[model samples]
Target chain A: MKYPGGIKKQGSSSINYANRGMNFEADINVTNSYYINNDIAVIYKKPTPITINKVDYKSRVDAVITEAHFNTPSTTDYNGIYKGKYIDFEAKETKQNYFPLSNIHKHQIEHLNKIVRHGGIGFILVNFVKLNKIYLLEAEKLCSFIESNERKSIPIEYFENYGYLIKPKFNPRIDYLNIIDQIYYGGKL
Target chain B: MKYPGGIKKQGSSSINYANRGMNFEADINVTNSYYINNDIAVIYKKPTPITINKVDYKSRVDAVITEAHFNTPSTTDYNGIYKGKYIDFEAKETKQNYFPLSNIHKHQIEHLNKIVRHGGIGFILVNFVKLNKIYLLEAEKLCSFIESNERKSIPIEYFENYGYLIKPKFNPRIDYLNIIDQIYYGGKL
Candidate 1:
């Protein structure tokens, strides 16, 4: 399968989604990392940080990542660039709700708020593992739900009520950039 | 110590560079992650992408980062954003001769080339462990040496020739943001 914008040549690291054991996030990460490398549009998943208790630095300087628990709840899991516009997002996979705005952190919401105010594009790539469904909820809808959910729980129905479900595809796999092409750049994949 | 930009307050994680035994990259990572959560910036160490062979997702969700290995040589160590600007760089440390340009990858040079073409700020962070001196070398110059090093090797004299040495500091320790502030943001730190 050929992807425009020179995606087919993005190295095969992206083509194979390790469905054998990994869950939704790892799959999406491999896919996104593949896209960024191909220059399709620079996007990536932030590695779960590890605390380094010590380093041997045997030679070529490989500081092994030890078990370092996150000091705080994360804001968003992914951030990068598309075209020239900054791209930031969080990926959430839910079995029951698919996506209730409550899964997002408050500070993360605030971080996206900063992204939006700074003239950047922000959103979420929600995976409904049960439905095998994916949705690209724009930052605006996400923010609104977050603001309202503060007063009450945002039911999963609310998301299915108002969210852009991205049908998963092969070839470019997630092919998320296609959505960006239409929504942000005003075109079709 | 009060660091500018409400750092430690934004997240529970704080830079404990003293006890950290990891080489240069890990130190910067702890520091950079500290900076991001503080709302000072959003930076991440890009994970070395892997092609997974197996998975055992017992239930509908959740999987561990159990086993994986690099499918290819890495281009750079860390990259993310700061103040809405796309930030990219390679990190290296050496007890001798600062850090050799040869330690950097050719693909990384090409990658940074693309980053700069796209109107993003790109550079290399060099830590001289023996001398305890850090320098933010512009990608442009790094590329020059990388391209020419095929003839022989990058002489340390070159780095000793043109690199902005960054010293370790307390509040916001990595302080590359300060360099970014001066170079990309157009203000003094």
Candidate 2:
């Protein structure tokens, strides 16, 4: 729920609410940077898309966007390479015990499936903030749960049983890549 | 350069200039989509980043960005999985005989080098728009040239010698993946 310094707040009341939503993403960004700096991996979160409607040309080198709107991303938030393998995943934070199915879009699920089909590693990082637990669940399991029609929300117990737990670290914050090494590479390195 | 239909143009005066610049990207997007639809590959171009300065909230779901500026990208534009291997590259179009090194940033070059060091496939797709020639040059060769300090721009002769020429097709437009298969896998498939 902690907010980073770079994100600007508008209207005093909504600051806390916005920070809580952005904390998970910011933490992952920091973790990825740590990995990159240490030569472990080169994962990165894709930037949020913004559609520009108007631009004000202040100078030849400075064109400021006057009006814009957020655009929906066509793929997952995070993707990169680790040990010659392509890694793709989406991270979601949920306050409830059950993760809502609607948090993920249909195309993103399809994209994850396609990645797996193409022989790349694809998964989801689910953060249950209330309980301070994060699980790295493979995309195959998530897709299966989606197809089974068991419930609208996946219970926390299901993740606890099927997914690998990612231990939060002080240096990297959320060390999800370590969980990746354990699950994908069998902790070989 | 021929412009595609999907890209939105801001004004009439800027249309020609914008379209010319966007053609290469738009063509690659079509080519990627073709590959995706045919179950060949799952490559995607990362969205351009925008730093938000101000926002106007119309409703709970309708928050519009009133002010913003373009943010510099930290890595290459296109990346994805191809045959279980991490594929990463940057595409650039130039009208001159030599490709200017300044067209690419220092961080992007560093990012490409990192990908190669971690056992991933990395390269640059250079398009000579005036000549209608596209070449897929491996990152190792590009880095070597960069390290050698031979010239500020990469001469066309070097690309013709070390790079793989990608033949434009009617269906996919730029069939760079075919060249990838040929070079990376010895055209076994």
Candidate 3:
């Protein structure tokens, strides 16, 4: 199997072996770069928001931030144009059996709802790290679950039923776009 | 005329007075908020990209960045869904009679070009602050100019001729969408 960093693993029958000890965010970043290079999409993870309080201008191009504080992001971490459609999503990795709603902030959910209302594609990617399973849950279904149930977390079964499983693959790594094509683009891929 | 901060300025017939002493980025931020509040669009200026070097987790909620450095953005400053279309643009305020191409990074232009190629609306908003004139130049025209000429900057005449003029408004302040509607949506606004 093809592993990350272009290394081939001999006799590695499972995808988990390839992803073992790899960072989730880094994997997504690589996948995004792959998509960009292949001219497939233009998705990007937004920079972590911060409020700068102090800076040291060492030179014209060497200004170093001395003090800053993280600010709550008002929108999803990832967003861009995909096939002429506005795609927005947040991704998180959990080591538990259930995906906690608290992993996403309240304002972020509202922001996703607004995106969906404005005719943009909005969803969340939750990776059950321990189970080595990932699911892409649309904003509509997520909001429905929040409204209908009193539970703070969504079980794996619910994801298996409502969310689309994102099987890990070589080259692009996580093939979430495969599911996107199936669901939104009439299986054009 | 309706001034910034919702203050009504009397006997000011020109849009220049309303924008005098006001920061261009702040004006766009206020305009974006107005668009969001009115459900007109979902555009936003991305957070300034930075490379965090060190952080101090004083407590669970109060982690402070002690060292960081600004990183050049790979994409435009603003992008979002507008009328079910992917909208991407970079905004710049130039006090000079010509807008320097150096104001926009090389990769940013490439990124916008890719966006337009992928069926997204891509443009650059050049606000000639001194003339109180703002123009939205589409990616096609911008790239054409870059390809045909050896000029380091675009003259104000080029903007006046080829770019869509964005007139200042009361509630929305910088009404670029008004121009977008006229150009792309058959003046649906």
Candidate 4:
């Protein structure tokens, strides 16, 4: 059985919720790192938010966390500056044919809305594993979809219609920034 | 004895390192909340980075982390969009008359420099507890100091000369944004 990208794999030898969406996340991290190194952009994946409950001071510099729990993130998973523009986004993947709106939190959508309203770029990267396609859906477009339609999940057709397809490639892997450049900067890059 | 804003109080009932700089962090959190509520800007404190080891999934929704370790953050503590500009900064407080260079990690400085080079507004908020003063030191200015001088720490006088003093007040306690307005937008707000 194939697990979707975002779902946590249970009872695995490597039990890390940080690896919830390992493949997609790894792709994005590689892309962001490449962007930073090449001086094309300076984007970073915000660390997974976790609430610490107990810690043992093994040493001053080395503290071992004994208890903790992951908290729902208040903001997007990734954000940074690209071409002097504030960029923010959440990356997700699904084994299904459609991208589920439930994959994103309500407040995250609100946060993205606030970012866009304040003149920052905000979007979501949705990867359809079955279709072998990735799409960059702007927050504005996503919000309008939610408002116009009562669909809980965004169908592949909607993404094809409104979302910009990001072609996967070597080196940078997921070239979302190229799509951003095309849409926002008229392919200036 | 008054504990300075950034130092962690060790071994006195509470041991969560998240409280390493509680007073100053709380103040900033409150200030950022006020900004968001008032539609001023969209800034947020990135969560403390942690490397999760083991987890106990009591149920699907609730997962308890059994073992973990705090990771040194690669980027600054706070970042967001302010007035259609990318804003990034590390907030630190020093008990000494001089702010020590050791408080900030080396790579964080590099990260800030990259942000500034990319045309983002990058700065550091240094709170001097004894002096009862806070200063917003721009990344460019800080880099110049680091390059020109071999000084291990920045004297309060340097802050007085090179940094914009942030006057503490009610509501938005740390009014650093006001300083940004004065410097960046000529006090337009």
Against the native complex, each candidate's DockQ, computed on alpha carbons, is 0.18, 0.66, 0.89, 0.72
lDDT of each: 0.64, 0.85, 0.87, 0.87
Give the range of the ten consecutive residues with the poorest summed lDDT in model 1 chain A.
Answer: A63-72
| All models, RMSD in angstroms | 7.9, 7.8, 2.3, 9.1
Q: How do the residues A107-144 of candidate 2 rate in per-residue lDDT, one tens digit apiece?
A: 89999999999999999999887776778899999988
Candidate 3 clashing pairs, residues 3+ apart or interchain: none
**Candidate 3 DockQ, CA atoms:** 0.89
Expressed between 0 and 1, the share of native interface contacts present in candidate 2 is: 0.88
Worst 10 residues of 3 chain A by lDDT: A12-21
Q: Against the true chain A, what TM-score does chain A of candidate 4 give?
A: 0.87
- How do the residues B1-189 of candidate 3 rate in per-residue lDDT, one tens digit apiece? 455567656543644444542577887888999999999899999999999999999999999999999999999999999888999999988889999999999999999999998889999998887887788999989999999999999999898899988766655777889888988988954
Model 4 lDDT tens row, B96-151: 99999999999999999999999899999998876767789999999999999999
Q: Which stretches of candidate 3 lie over 4 Å from their true place?
A: A1-22, B1-22
Ranking according to lDDT, highest score first: 4, 3, 2, 1
Model 2 achieves a DockQ score of: 0.66
Q: After superposition, how far is residue A118 of candidate 2 from its true place, in Å?
A: 0.8
Clashes of 2: 0
Candidate 2 Cα outliers beyond 4 Å, as residue runs? A1-22, B1-22
Give the interface RMSD of each candidate.
4.7, 1.1, 0.6, 0.6
Instruction: State which candidate, 1 or 4, has the greater lDDT.
Output: 4
